[model samples]
Target: MARRLFVENGFHATGIAAIAKESGVAVQQLYRDFPAKEDIIAAIVEADCERIADQNTLNTAVANKDRAGIIGWLTTTPCHKDESGDRMFLEIAAEGARNDRIRSIFQGIRDQADENISRAFAGLMDSDMVEDEHRTLAQAFMIVSFGSIFLRTLNQEPVTPASEKLITCLIESATP
Candidate 1:
């Protein structure tokens, strides 16, 4: 409930009273669970990560050793459809730019993503592919994924198919 409120209202807009009221819990109980808005945001981010990590797509990608399949899975996943989740992720990302702890957490997530991509690609490509090339593709993939989310959130344009095409080209480029 606190996560929803924080995502909908942002860090500054959400209040403990509102969280307590919405959650049907005492304000003190809410405080006991989370001392600050940042804590709640962190918990939300953690939950989102866990959800993504536990997705069947990740399992399929690992088992099939398919780069394109992994990209397709990532593009089609509805994980980011939650408006509150999107808003909260953006807010924390922005805050990460200035906060060491937030930055560290964000960096950890990025690292894990990169590692996963590398593992996914290892079976699709030969040893001739360089680590830098793999990392570059992973970063590009992340950019496209996040850009699609933002564009969708704004109702500007749908970038998912375009991003899939871009990722396909990237995979080809990394091939031997």
Candidate 2:
């Protein structure tokens, strides 16, 4: 409810009372759960991280050292069609730019994503080590992934082909 409200009315415009009303929870209970709006965002981020981590598909591919699995995961993993969820993240991202706490939360998300991508790159290259180049490639993958989300949700543009090609090309070019 708060996520939808944040996406629809933005972070600043959506107040605690509004969130409480929308969620049918008392404002005091909401405050007990989340001290501030930023806390809500933080909880949302943590929940999202848990959800993705729970998938474990990439972890399985890496554990098995499956190049095909890694490549498939990289190319097809994160192209979500959930506009509300994407929009909510974008809202949090925008808030991140101005607020230090939010920025930290957002950076944590990016760091975790980078680590996951790096692990996948290691598996794809059949290397036990994660190198600087792997981190660099992981960063590029995040750019393509997030940029695709931005374009798809905001501009209503199709980004699957381009994103998949870029991810695949990155993997192919980086692997020996």
Candidate 3:
């Protein structure tokens, strides 16, 4: 219910009353479960992280210590296809840029993702890659993902081959 409201109205426009009505709960009950809309957003973000973490691609890459595989997992994994899903995430990110609460939530998720990538790289390379290197790769991956999202949102042409090429280059650079 909250997800539908958030997707349709955006984070800024969604009100607790609407969520309560959609959920068939009193506003007070909703507050008891989630203190604020930001709390709801955080819960959704956490759920997304959990889902991504459980993917077969990530699990296999982590088990086999495959850097390229890990990159593939991050880059090639299909995101939600529905417009509502896209809007929900994009809205959260856009709001995060201006809201400290949202920004903190995003930052936590980003930090955890970077750490996981660093661990995956360490296993693949069998060498100690510094924190800075992992951070650099994480930022690059984030930019690539966001760029793809933006292009798709704008109805631009597909860039899959180009992205794969770039990922290949990054793998080569990261390998020992």
Best lDDT among the predictions, by candidate number: 2
lDDT of each: 0.68, 0.84, 0.71
How do all models score by TM-score?
Answer: 0.77, 0.93, 0.82
lDDT by residue for model 2 over 1-176, one digit each (tens)?
98888889999999999999999999999999999999999888899777754448887888888888787777765665678778877887898989999999999998888888888887777788998988988988899888988899889777888888888788887677
- In model 1, the runs with Cα more than 4 Å from the true position are 55-60, 63-81, 126-130
What lDDT score goes with residue 19 in model 3?
Answer: 91
Model 3: per-residue Cα lDDT over 130-158, one tens digit each: 36776676577666656665666557456
Query: Model 2 lDDT vs. the true structure?
Result: 0.84
Per residue, candidate 1 scores C-alpha lDDT tens digits across 1-176 of 87777667766678888988998999998889989766766677788877765546765765766666765554454234666566666777777898777777777777777766655555356542437767776678678767766766677455667767876776676565
Cα error of candidate 2 at position 119, Å: 0.7
- Clash-forming residue pairs, model 3: none
After superposition, the stretches of candidate 3 with alpha carbons farther than 4 Å from their true spots are 55-60, 63-72, 77-83, 128-130
